[model samples]
Each structure stands twice: as structure tokens, then as C-alpha cells.
Target: MNSVSRRKFFGLMALGAGSMAMLPGMAFGAAKAKTSAPGQTSLAAGQAMARIKALIDELRAEGRAFAADALASDNNAQWDRLLNHYFDRKGFASISVNAANLCPSLKPVNRMAALVRDLLEADISFPMRGELAKASLGHGLTAVKDWFGLGGSDAKADFLLALTANSTMGNNFVNNGLVTSGFMDPQKDNIVVWDVNHPTNYDAWMYRKATQGWGADSIRILKTKMFASSVTEAERKAGTIPSDPQNEDEIIAALLALVDERTKLVTLSWQSNECGMVLPMQRIVSELRAVNKNIHIHADSAQTFGVLDLKLGQVDVDSIAGSFHKWPCGPKMVGILYMNNKHGAAERFTPSIWGYDEYINTPADYGFAASTGTIDPNAKRFSYLGQQNDATLVATWMAALFHTGQLHPGVTPAKIEARIHYLGGQVQQALFKHLPKVFPDFTPKTAAQWIATPTSNARLRSSVYLFKTPDGIVAGDVMKHVYEQHRFAIANLKVMGHDLLRVSPTICNNAKDVEDVVAAVVDVILAMKKKTLANNTHTRSYA
Candidate 1:
């Protein structure tokens, strides 16, 4: 890759088709404010990124030693290192590439939005460029409130752009936390249950109990299932494990016996992108903040954000959504939603969005006509739901400068969630020893249930795992015939109701990219078992 070989870098990008039209997303040409010259707009945004430096020299020839060198088994080098780490070259001159030569002042997009509010701890000037621990969801809600003693709860954190940390940002944080937690007496807020067992986070709290006003008896269903653990060393020498008829004290006593006292809210997903299973979510947000410290928890950490070590200022929540292109290689409608400034407090969060002055929660002593309106007491009052662009909000500070490794200190979101729970349990013990010699109907789990240590025989480890499906094939057609015969990106998904195959590994994955993706899923299940034993001996020689 370093020698520029994607067929000689698409044959030198066929000698510039107008510099490959800013090569799609960032070679920029449309920003208008004609009157050039003031370092001629950072030299035509560094000469349109020096003619997009032959696509940043083919993304610095595939890898610059890191930037999540594409969670390996070479998912076509993690989709060309998530598109050249979001087209960056010295953070693409703070990503203002030629909107006439961009940066028509929001003062460097408010200093890259205060360097992402100082990498989520605010006041930030961009220095911690190595072990990147600064306020990533306030250090993952202060490591789930000092590992669940819920250090005197009440949390606050905010940033926006979420999609799969639960869709429509988990139904607008349970319909704006039941219209700013007044929870208007429906038989005293008595139902908001979850767990059609993680049907994509119980169909987002059953799509706000069937479209708005948290109805249909607020919500119901705690019947859970998502299992996968088949532990071994002879099932840990016969101590056995996969008995998951839904554990975690039976999903926290089926979500604390569907908390009556007119429950406010309680979304889930501290883990379970279809069963990699972690859900303790600090004993379900410290036993629902000891059963109602104003319940409205919301976690949906879409496959557990940047791989756990989270802090969110001591974990008993009020809100927290996730997404930054999973396991934080960042970009893709970037996301972060952490409310709890006393329920987005600028005096009990009233601004649903007021960039044009619904008086964004006024109080500049309502004088300069309360300076074109107020609002933002937290969770960025659901971060401006409409037009607010300073080059995609300064490319969310070059995707938080490649997630606080200042664009490349060789990746960190706590080192790619401890290399996706120890190289995703060594690619699930090399797919439980090459999937029963190429599909005798494989079913794996438990090389001591993927070892990331919790010991009462193991619990904390999610890097993503799963297998089943050989019987009548069709899990997306052997996942597109092992990704068109072994380039192997992997993952088919749909957990408890079958499908499976999901692998899941990240952080420039080593161990020979999990032994070249379990030897290309054993050469794509031995070429679909020698074309299904030559079509069952040509259907017994045509009967």
C-alpha cells in the first residue's frame, strides 16, 4: 500500500479530471465571498490541498502507521481508512478547502468549536494529543460512575449528530425526557418498559409508545433474550456458562419490575449491537438511580462508544446517545448527545432549538434584545436541528482530531477499546478453530467467553462476535460469498433470531488480521462446500 498501489493509485487518477473535482467530498470549489487575498485564503486552502495531494498520496499510501488502520483483516483497509481519515492532511487546513478558499470567519469555526469544547472537557486548546482521555462523554460518564457505586449521580455532557446510538437520537431522548420531566400524571407516570429484548433498543422505546405522548400505557415488554457465551476449557472445566435466558440479575429484575411511581423513562444499550453483550450499564444506571432519582436514563451507546472506559461525569444518567462511526474511528454524521444539565438546564431546558431567537432561554438580562435569543443550558438544547454550517461545523474539528490523538497518535478511544476487547478475542479463537473445517454448521462462543476479565467466570468483553448459519446458508448469501470470495469485511447480523456471522474487531487489528479473517472464513466455507458436494452428486445423477 505504501508504494501507491491501488492499481497504481487508479493510474495516477487519470491525470486530473479537474483535480478529480476536489476528489468528491473535499476538494472544494463552491464557497463564495469574492475578494481574495489575506494569505489568499490560506493559499487557496493550501492550493486546494495541493491538488488533493494525489488523494493524500493515496491516503499516505494506505496507512500512516495508524488512524485505526482499518480494523484489519483489511476491510479494504477499513474502507480506505474511513476515507482517508475523513480527507485530512494537517486536518485539511482545518477543513476549509476552497469555498472560494473557505473560512469566511466564524473565527476558524469558533476555534474548531472550542476544539470540541476542549475535547469534551472544555476550555480546550488542543494539546492532549496522545492517550486521548479528555472528556470523551466526560470520560465515558466517569467510568460509569466509579464502576457503579454511582458516585453521587446527576450527570451532564453534550454534543450532537447521532443516528444508531438509537435512531432519531433515541426518539428525541424519550420525547425530550417526557417534555422536560414534568411527566404530567398518566396514572402517575406508571409505564415506560423496554426489552422486546433489544429489538434495536426495543424499537426505540417502542417508537415513543406508538407515535408520541408516550402512550399505549406509556410502553411495555421486558421479555429479554440476546444470548452467546458457550464458554469452554470443557465449559471452563464443567462450570458451564451460556445459560443466558437473560441475565444481569434477570435484566435488572426485568427493568426493576417495570418501575411504577409512574416511571419517567429508561432507554437501554450499554452493549448489544446484536449480542456482543455487555449490558450491566453500571447496574442499569445504578438501579435506575436507586429507583427514580427522577428517572429518564437514556444510554443506547450504539455498540458502546469508543470502547468503554466511559465516565459521563459519574454515570447515573439523564441522557447520552452515541455514534462517531462506531468504536470511534469518527465521522459519518458524527454524534454525541449528553443532556443532564439538570435536564438541559438553562433554567429547566425550554429551547427546543432557537438559533433565530425563541430567546434561547434568555438572561443576558434580556437587554440587547436578549442578543438575538438564547438557549443551551446543556446537551446543546438538542444541537440546532437545522441550518448551521461552518464547513460541516468545522468537520467536527476534523472528527475531534481523529478522536483526540490530534489526528494521529496512532488511534485512541482508549486504544480502540482495548483493541476491541483484546483483538476481539483473537478473532473469536480463530473462529473456533476455522469454523468446524469450513461449515459443518458452525456455532461458536466461549474461549472462556471472550476473556476481557470480569471473573465469576468472565463477563466484560465486547469486540463483537457470532457464527451460526451453515445449514441452508443464506446469511446474506454467506455474507456475499465471503465478501466476493475473500476480501473479507465480515458481519451479517440479526442476533437471537438467527442470521449471525458478525466477527467485530478494530484498532488496526493485529494477529495477522485475525489470521487473515479466519483464513478468509476458511476460503469462504470451502467454496460453499465444493459447490455443495457437487450439487449432491448432480442430484443423484438426475435420480
Candidate 2:
């Protein structure tokens, strides 16, 4: 992944932070893993990582070669072997690729991505132009009836191939939803969202109302203060969820409280990237719909995309945009946007980047008349952003399959959540015990409050934890000492005027990792204080 184009970035002057995998030991079409060593159950981590590097080199070469070979021949049998070999993993259903299930108009990179998506059973309804592109895209789209609902009437969010940058997708979804709901057309509409100062939930709404000089429509922001470190202590000790009677309800009511006929759209986040705060989206959507049935709801799920399960059938959000790199452990600079076309959100979502229109034969069906006009009726309307990294795009599916399929013990999304929450809870509990003694000035209000995860029934928390230090202790200096001395690369960030320490615990991390980081943090803070005292003593002695 490389720097996103400034043009694309400027489009996100407000929104949230943007943030792939493959399998091992197995091949496609009933191929078995040959034993490298006798009775070898699995490869070592170092070996596994090295294999991934080698695999990337192989994929780049083989993918390009296959595309080139695919170009010269029209035979489906020829390319099917190559596609199935690289794409087919252990857990997923078998998939084959050819002109019938590939987006023809796409450049080779995008075509490879289409093949990966085809393996994931995500149909293509993209709006990219080319007499060749339309036919190519449709071949892939016609494969799956529903991407997310692979089983019975599961009614989940579908998989659409959206080759977009992360921050750009949030604004795209929100603005498009608002526009389609007749809010952004100078019609007076009230937009309600969170004001944690995160770009996705906060400032993008600000730009639309303030930047566009639309003074008639109102934007009410839901505001909340950061909970104290003590809160985490109480929750951990009690071994229960926080009873923040005032905080949770207030946040939900504040947004739903603003709903009325004038309210046309509401955009929010599933998790805050800066703080590991998970909002009660399930309930927030539930209450919002009850109040204003017409409000178009969109969620920025960059941090929670691969972390959360297929519960969208309950939340019923109109649109969700997320990145592959963060929790999914995939590459960066790639984003996935899912729309609720199954539940009638298709007509309500108008693509902001309606760059091309060639997927559907009846253009009028999707509000487009001809080649240069109209958005696709499906979420594919948003997939028309110009050129994209083909390798990274295709790798998204590979990474998705790797994590959701191959990441062991905690394999499914539900299991993954449990592992992360357990790790995060460990850090939360340890910090509660260590922070006070480490910094005498630190007096938190709640014991285990930061362990707050909004999904009550799921108990699925983010793998991230945050702690703020006083002015005398520079967070960057502490971060430097920890990284340099202890080899612990903890994040030192400034959010909402507070200099904070951010820690993330994943499958790669465990209780020992948390203990090591806490110990390092204690040493760094104490060392800084000792150095400060010595300097003060030297200055006084000289004075």
C-alpha cells in the first residue's frame, strides 16, 4: 500500500481514520499439503510469515501471467485451474474463474480482484464502463444470488467489490445516503450523529452543512465525555458490564432524541479508532428506526468490520464502509463498502462517484439512461472510482479467507471477537491494578470502565486500550523509551486534547505481552520522573 492520492484525501477533509491473508498447508481442488517434515502439524510463526512473503512474490508473478494468458484465450477450462489453485483455500467453497465470472472491462489488477471476489461468492454489479467491462462485470455478478446470505434467509450484509480508499468511503456513503433521501438538495433536513470528534461520525457532517452553506438544514451532534480509568477497575472487579446509566442511554437518546420528519440521514461508527470505544449501534439503530422510520442510517465500521459477526440483519444499517487492514490483518489502502440492497436501501443510496455506467443493460432501471449517466441500482454504483491497486484488491479476499477461515482456535468472527476481547480485558484489568501505583497523580473514577463494549449480548470488545498521562510526562518520550528499551511498540497518540497511550492485543499477543508492556510503561514513567528529579536537583544545587 502507498500514500492515497491527495485528491482522494481532500475529499475526506472530514471522516475517520482508514486503517489481507492467505492460507497455509493446502492447495485447491482436493490437493493435500505435502509434509515438509515427518508428522508436521503446522509451520512455525517465523516460517509461516516467511511463506507469506514468498507467496506474495509468487502471486504477483502468477496473477499477472494468468491475466496475460487469460487475455489470449477464450477457453474457460484454461484459466479455471490457475484461479482455483491460488484462490481456493481449505474452508471456503470451490470457485472457478473465467470470462463468465470476471469483470472484463477492468484492467488486469481489478480483474484479479474480481476473481478473488468470485471465490468469496460475491457477485459483481459494478458500474465500470467498457463494452468489455460490462460483460466482464456481469459474468461475476450473475454467480451469487446474495453475498452475505450464503445460507438460508440469513438476511445479512452482502459482499460488493468496492475498490475505494478508506476515509473517502465514509463520506461517500453518508453524503450519498443523505442526497438520495432528499436532504442534501437544499431541502431542510436534520442530520444526527456522534461528536466524539472522530471524522467519520463528526466533521464530515460538519462539512456538508457548514461547507456547503446549507444553513436551513440542522446537524445535532451527540456529545459524551471520556470515562475515567477507574471505571475499568470496577467492571473488572465486578466481572460485569458497566452500569453507566447516565452515559449509555444519554448517548443513544441524544441521537434518537433529534429524530423527526426533518431528519433524513444519520451516520455513525461501530467503533472509535482513536479510543477503543464501541458504541451501542444495535440499540442505536433500533431506537432510531422506531422514532423516524424514514431516516437513512449508515455506519463507519472500519475498526469493527472483520471483528463483528453477521448481525446486520438485526441492525439493518443502510450502508457500512470498512477497511481490510486493521482487524482483518490484511493490506492497507483498500476498503469494502456494503449497502443494504436486500432491505430496500438500494434506492435510498445514490453513489457520489458515479464515474461510469455499463453493468446493467436496462440503464433506466438504475436511474441512468445511457453510457455517461445514472448510478447502478446496486452498491456497485460506488465501485467506479478510477484506477486501483489490482494486487491489493484481490488480496482483500485472500486475507478475508485467511483470517475468517484459517486463523485457528478463534476461527469464526464470533470466536475472533472472544479472543480479542479476552486479550483486551487482560490489559484493561492489568492497567487498572498498575496505573495508580505507577503514577500517584492518576486518580480514575471507575475501576473497569474502559472495558466498555457496546455489544452487551456479544461481550465482544476491541483489542485496544487507552491511558492518558500527566503534563510532566511526555507521552512521546515514554513511547520512545518503551520501544527502544523494551522493544514494545505501543502507540502514543493525542486525541481530544489528551495525550494518551494506546495498546492493542491480538492473537499475536497474550497475557505475557500485556504484562511486558505494563512493566515497560512503569519503567518508562519512573525513569522519566527520576531523570526530572535529578535535573531539578542539579539546577537547585547550582542556583
Candidate 3:
């Protein structure tokens, strides 16, 4: 079963237990039979069916009432309403069509739905990240070679390491077998390991700081940051800069300063919150090249991928790692890594099990050789196929074809981004109209503003709109209420160290979906208000 189904099953079990406790008379027990005959099995079966139908009817009625309340009360602060009320219908339709197109081996009908749920429920963890690495190892290495201007034997060795690293689980295979063997050591530390300075730098600092007798003098740290100096003229004119400096140049400069030459350096950047955030990565790339050609530039464009049309050549980026599932809405297993020709530090430093002598300086043989056996067995195991691989493949291909055909590659990302932005604006407008009645002084200006109100910016992505309820309601509880009550499946953004309802609209959704989700959120908020008032009265009476 998919994660969502498992959750639902658990919910039902809990609810049934709770209901039994609340109403002991309705608890499971022997019931009176109409026939009063021991052999009347058929009659018993019919009676059981009738009971089941009645239960279903009751649930349906409850669901209708709940949905109506959501629409009438204007509680758009909940996650379930955002997901189920808005896009669930279209998603269900797509899933149904995809399931039918799938092969018979898999329980196509349920399989498609399960896959969809799995995709939604999948955790953003190392396992998922590793899967992405496994799938794009070869491509990443190739991009590195292309970016770094590596050629001849050097390029050939780099390709081999790429293959080995792709196939292997760790860098040991590449380091010992490739670098120590003296077959690929020439390019070690020269390719400039390009990566965003995130948890990597933070982790490294934490580790170093934790070490006993560690001093600043012991480490030669050069802080060269890459950032925009100020917000752009347009952003200033638009009055978009609220608090933070939106210039990419200053941001990059700050990032560059944080880089310590004692170890590998990674630079990080986020999408421009204001229109003027300019990334000086291209300039940084150029400066680093002129100063030291060996530096490898790893770019993490996970946040910027679909929103921006990146000019790979202009930026002089050596290696790039991105999450496809985020903005692209592609298969969960997919991600992209671009590397320059000269950037083969990992392969040059890490070696494979096979001796380096067997593989020569050639892209084809070395390319496949480097990454032939490192993939984790469990990484691809338990795919949410549910036995319908063929139908799934066809459906996935069809979705790609349909979306790409209609949207076009060059235009798809931009168009979808714009639409999401507009939808977010609409949601904000709706929230402003409803939130103040329940939450006075509730002025949600932008998606970022809403998420940041509770310092949820670290966890919530730009694509999602998230906000906390005034009464501190858990996002999961609100999500359940919305889905079970409205047949919608809005998701919660869990990364920001706290729970908040997330509103994410993809190509499958339109303005109506956005509005519906907003309406549902409003309903949730109103319901919360009612519950609070009732609880307050009860407390007063007790006192």
C-alpha cells in the first residue's frame, strides 16, 4: 500500500476504536437476526450488506455537510482543503486515465493512484537524494567534463571515475582504485568541487568546531563570497524590498566570504525574493577561472531550475545538481547534474574496486566502467509500480508527451511558474478577504510573507504557500479534516521545523482549484474559531 493508504487505514482504525469507546452500545458484539434460524447464512449476508451500505451513506452525508461548511465558513487555512478541494478531482481523473492505459499485470486502477500518493508522500531524504544521484551519475560526470574543458586522457579518466562513482555506493571505490592507483590522480583537487554552501559548509564547520584544540590559526580560511550588492533599480521602483537585500551580487559575495579554502567549498543561492536579486555566479566563475583554473564550481539550482532559463555557458558552472521533482513535476526518481570536463575531483580522488589499469583513457569504455556497479539494490526496490509497469510507463510517457506537446520545453517552465505566481496572488487575495474576520490584523501580503510570519521560510519552498493557524493547530490534523470532510488532499510542508498548510498548484490545477483551496482554508479557520469559542465558554463555566 502507498503511504497515503497506510495513513488512511491507521486513521480508520483509530477512529473506530475512539467511536466504540464513545458509544459503548455501538461496539462490536452479537446482533439480533431477523430469521432466528442458525442456517440462514444468506439472510445474514444480506443484513451485513445493508449495514455496510448504511454506514457508507452516513459517511457520505457527513462528508457533504463538512464540505458545505468549508464552503460556507471560508476556512482556507487548512492543508486538506488546499489539496483536495482544488486539484484532487483533476488529479483523480489523470490517475484514472493513466491506470487504464497501463498493462494488466499491475492493478492499474489502484497502482496509478498509489504512485501519485507515493510521489506526494515521499520524504525528501538522503535515500531519495541518492536515488537521484544513481540515476544521473553518468550525466553529471559528462556535464562536469563539458564545463571544465577537460580533454584527451584526462577527460577519459574523469569519465571512468564518473561511471565507477555512479555504480558504487561511496567515493572509496573511486578514491582507492582510481586516484591512489596513480591512474587518475593528476586531476585531483583541480577540477574545483562546485557545490552550494549549505548543510555541507555548516556540517563541516560543526565538525571542526566540535574538535578539541581546534583554532582559527590551524585552518587557512579564505572568505570569498558571491552576491549582489543591492536590490535592482526595478525592484526598488516596484517597492519590493521589504527587509532583506535582494541583490544576487551581495548574496554571492557573502557566500564567497564563508568559503574556507582549507576544505571543499560550496556556494548556495536562493531564487530572488525581490525582482532585483542578481546572481554574480557567471562573474564568480570567470574570476575563479582566471585566479586558479583548478577550482570546480558546483551549482545547486534546485530552487531556480524551472523558474529560470539558465544559460549554462554564461554562468561558467562546472557542476550542477537539481531536484526535478520540485519544479519540473517529473518522476520522483529523476534529477539533473551537470559537470564540466575538468571537474572530476570525486573520480580522481575516489577509486573503484576494479583496477585502474584495465580501463584506458576513453569516454565510452571508461564512462560505463566508472559507474557499472555502485547503485544501491534497495534504491530502486519497492517502486510504487504495484505490478503495472507497462501501463505506468505508457502513462508517464503520455503525461510527458501531453504536457511537453502542449507547453513546449522552452516555454513550459516559465508558463507554469507564472501561473503558480498568479494563483498564489489569488490565494493571498482570498485569504486577506477572510482571515481578518477570524484573525484580526491578518494581512498576508505574499506567499513568502505568510510562511515567514512564523519563521517557516527555511522549510517551505517558493512554490508552496504555507501559513500557521493562530491557535497553533497541527497541519496534519487540519489536513485530515479537509481530506476526509471534502474529498480533497492538500499537502503539508514539513521542512520548516514546524507544521503549516501548503498550497501548491501545478499545471493540472487552474484558478478555480486555487480558489477552492482558499475557500477550504477559510472554512477550516472559521471552524477553529467556533471550536475555540465553545472551549472558552466551557472553561469559564468550570471556573
Candidate 4:
């Protein structure tokens, strides 16, 4: 087939048009073109052509200099220069920081664009496309294992599968491992979740949705006594109780109390999304296992995956779900689900979608025969979805390379973790010292009162930090002002009824960026306060 026909053929296949049998006289490499054809100018064909043209146009429009620099660079200095150039090109020339929600890096985008450009231009056949897709998936899986510090021989013990996003993986675990596995009693069984801090909607809300119809009492939340309102406001007024409390012991006790023989599954984020509070996974797992050995434990590693040095071989969880877009600075619409296959954990959950490996169809002697094929007892079972974007998988591998220092030397996981923590601590200390100075009337002058994130315990610190806005000022308004006025990107979120502003600095940021962010926030807060006071005075004058 020529280039145009090949493009159209693949586009039609993507649009669910029938096989080659339907396209009469469409030979693979025919020298003569047939003037007459069967429905060659149909609407579906025109739509397919337009879609392919749009994709090609997009690929051509994206910047290719980053990819070119990466390919040409031979030394660490060159790679560093390329990295800076890439970030600047992505509109991060200023003090923008939104790594907690989504990374602003362009490494994954460049890699994906390059691969997609080549694939679209090449006259690749269907069989070759399948080979390339499987190869990309294999490479991506290997990179994921390496990110978790797993050896090649450990592939059978641990399996990794890709999904569209983190929420899909979380929902899969809840539906397959808890509800559909026939382990829950609905009346007696309940799932325990750390409810003090706000986990991602994927973790908390997914659990709620999964166990919705079981019963009103099917879900049990474990929270700190301080967060659960066990302390009175009178005590807070008297300064007898710490406004911000590091009640890990209380949280653990509450979690243990909630877990019993009836508890089926326990799920929580490895790091709290509201305020970078790292959960004590070791203690939680060990103690919970003592209560019920058959209990299933799941960790949503969205906030911890690429920023934290995690060795899955040492972690004793049944499953972990994480996304690459946040900390890893990888492509969007791609996430990973890791299952422990050594302990038969992978076999417990059935495939949620019927992919290529689900079954086999054959013709019987008399009629038709359809038999169930041997489902892969590993992560491959979950990855059998009909079609997937191969370029995205390759881009994931490229991101892993960039993160692990293959593409950028001296950028190992340890250095990345240290850099992130250092930046987070800088922001935390700056806010703690400056917020009180700016707002002298702000009561309860404690780090815990203002900084919603736990800072008393060093072990619980993470790259993500949250600050409670001053009274009479909305966090969302501050967030918008900072971004719109100063070109700074931060997050303002309402978690558990408390409004807080979040700042997360990643590998793409520097100390200068941190200083600028702090100053911008302070400037915004003071300006907003002055405006509010003037408005109140004008209202009084008019009255």
C-alpha cells in the first residue's frame, strides 16, 4: 500500500471499519489504482482521514528541539542544558510549581511526539504494529519494575500493568479484590481507611462507591482523636492542646480498633494528598496483619511513587496503584498497577476487561467451540485491552530513563528525593517564619495551626505542603491571584471542610523558584488583605 492508503487503512481500522475483505481491490502494494471502488468516498472514510491528518498536524506542531538536544548530547553538562531549555520551553521560565497535581516537564511530551511522528509517517503493516505495541509495553513494564528496584528475575514475583489513570487502577482493585472476590459479608465485613487526612478522590471515594450498596455500616473510617473532634474547643482556647498534632500513635490505635475478623480490606494513600503526611506503612501493615492475616492491604502511591525511594520487594502490601504524570513527570493518561504474584495475590482477581488473552474461539466438529484460554497469572492478564497507544508506553520508558539517570546523569532516585524534600523544607520554613509576620492578627500562631501539613515529625514530611489561609481570605482566591498575576501555579483545595493552599516543588524547580514562590504568596496575601480592608471601610462610609 502507498502512504496515503496505508494511513487511511490504519485510520479506518481505528474507527472500527470492517477488515480488508470489505475494501475491494485494495491491494497491499498494487501498481495500478482502481478508479471504481465500493464506497471509497463514504463519510466514515472522510472522518478517518481527517482524524489522522489532525494527529499528524499536532505532532508536527510540537517542539522537537528538546528531543534533538537529548539525542545530540553526550555529557552531563549538555543534558543539564537540555533539561533547562526543555523546562523554559514548557512555560516554566518563572516560579511556577504544580508538581503535586501535574508536572510541567516536557521530557515525556517530546519523547511521545517523536515516536508518534515516526510511526505515523512509516508505512507499517498491522502485524508490525502489533509487534511494536507489545515491545513498547514490555519496555515500559521493565522500566516500572526498575523504578521499584525490582530485579529482572523478580518479574514472576511482581507484575505491573498499565491503565488510563490512577483512578481506574484503584477502582479495579476495589471491585475485583474486595467486592467481586466474594470475601465481603456486607453485614459483618467492613473496610478500614485512614480518614483523618484527605486522600485522593480515587482512594476514598472509590472505596465508598464500591461498598455503597453493601450497607450503611459497611465502611469504617480510622481517624486521629484530634481530627475526630475528641478534643474540646475549650482546651484549644486554653492552649492546653497542640493546635497541630502528630498523633500517629492515636491513628494507629484507631486503625487497629477498627480492624477485626470482619475487616476484609484496608486502603490508604502512602502519603496524604491534603498535606504531605506520610503514613507509617510498616507499622500499619504489621499490626493489621496481626489482627487479621487474611486482610488485603492496598496503597495508593500517587504522591510517593517517583519522589520517594520505594523498593517494592521490601514492601509487604498486596497491591499498589500509582500514576506517572505527577512525580515521575511522565505522559498523561498512563498509570501503573502492581500486584504481588508470589503470594497468589494476582490470581484472586479476575480480568476486568476481556482482552486478547481472555479466551480462544475454535470450530468444533459439529458446531462451534469457544473455550477459555489460560489467563496470564501475572500483570499481563490485566493489560489485554484491545488497543492502546504504543507511543505513550514508550514515553513512559523514556521518563523512567530520564528519572533513573540514564538520560540525565547524576539524576538518580536518591538525589531526586533529596532535592524535593529540601525544596519542601525551604517552603515550609519560609511560610512558618513569614506568615506570622505578615498577619500579626492571625491567632493561634503555631506551625500546625497555619501549616496544615504535619511538620513535628520529620519522617512524615513529603514534597507536598499545605498552608491554611488567614481568616477572611479564601485559599482558592489566593491560588488564582498567584497564578494569574505572578505566573505561579499552585493548588487551592478544600479537604474535609478545611480550605488550604498546596505547594509541591519537583526536580524541575530550584532554590530561586522556591524564594520567588514564597515572596509571591506573601505579596498576594498582603494585597488581598489591604483590598478587603478598603472595601469594608468604603461600605461603612456609604452606610
> For model 4, what is the alpha-carbon lDDT of residue 218?
71
- What is the number of backbone collisions in each predicted candidate, taken in the order shown? 24, 25, 80, 1
Q: Order the candidate numbers by lDDT, best to worst.
A: 4, 2, 1, 3
Count of clashes in candidate 4? 1
The CA lDDT of each predicted structure is 0.44, 0.49, 0.35, 0.58
Model 2 is weakest, by summed lDDT over 10 consecutive residues, at 95-104
lDDT of 3 by residue, 10-72 (tens): 334333323222111122333443452764323332232233223323433433433332221
Instruction: Give candidate 3 misplaced runs (Cα > 4 Å).
Output: 1-246, 260-263, 267-295, 342-413, 427-438, 444-450, 453-462, 493-498, 532-543
Q: Which lDDT tens digits does candidate 4 get at residues 1-543? A: 654454444444433422211111112222232232565432222232233234323433343334443322123344455457545545554565767777764554454546654654552445345333433454445656676766444453214554444545644645554555456766668776665433443354445556555676576665432222134444433222221345656446556766778887787778777656777787878888898988878777777778887766667777777777788878776777777665556555665565331111111211322264345566655655555565565566556655665454445676667767777777777776668757664443345656666677666776677777677777777777787678888887776567777888776666556668877887887888888422121111000
lDDT value, candidate 4, whole model: 0.58
Q: Name model 4 segments beyond 4 Å from true.
A: 1-86, 93-95, 106-109, 156-158, 175-177, 196-212, 224-248, 356-375, 441-445, 532-543
Instruction: List where candidate 1 sits over 4 angstroms from the true fold.
Output: 1-180, 184-261, 270-297, 302-320, 323-326, 331-335, 338-393, 397-426, 430-507, 510-543
Candidate 2 lDDT for residue 442: 42
Cα lDDT of model 2 by residue, 1-543, tens digit: 122343233223111111011122233222232334766444332232233334434554544444433211223343244334433223322111111011111122333444433422421212111212311232222111122223233332123434466745755565645655454553466676765434655766677677666655477655444543223333333222232223455455445545677776777767665556666788877888888887778787776765656466566777777765555555457766766765556556566654432222233333566565555656666666655543455455445543343212123555556656666666766676687766564433443343222222224245556666545777767766676677766666566666666676554333566777877777778877778422111111000
lDDT of 3: 0.35
lDDT of 1 by residue, 111-142 (tens): 34444334335211112211121122222223
TM-score of each: 0.33, 0.64, 0.46, 0.74
Off by over 4 Å in 2: 1-161, 180-187, 228-250, 356-372, 406-410, 441-445, 448-460, 532-543
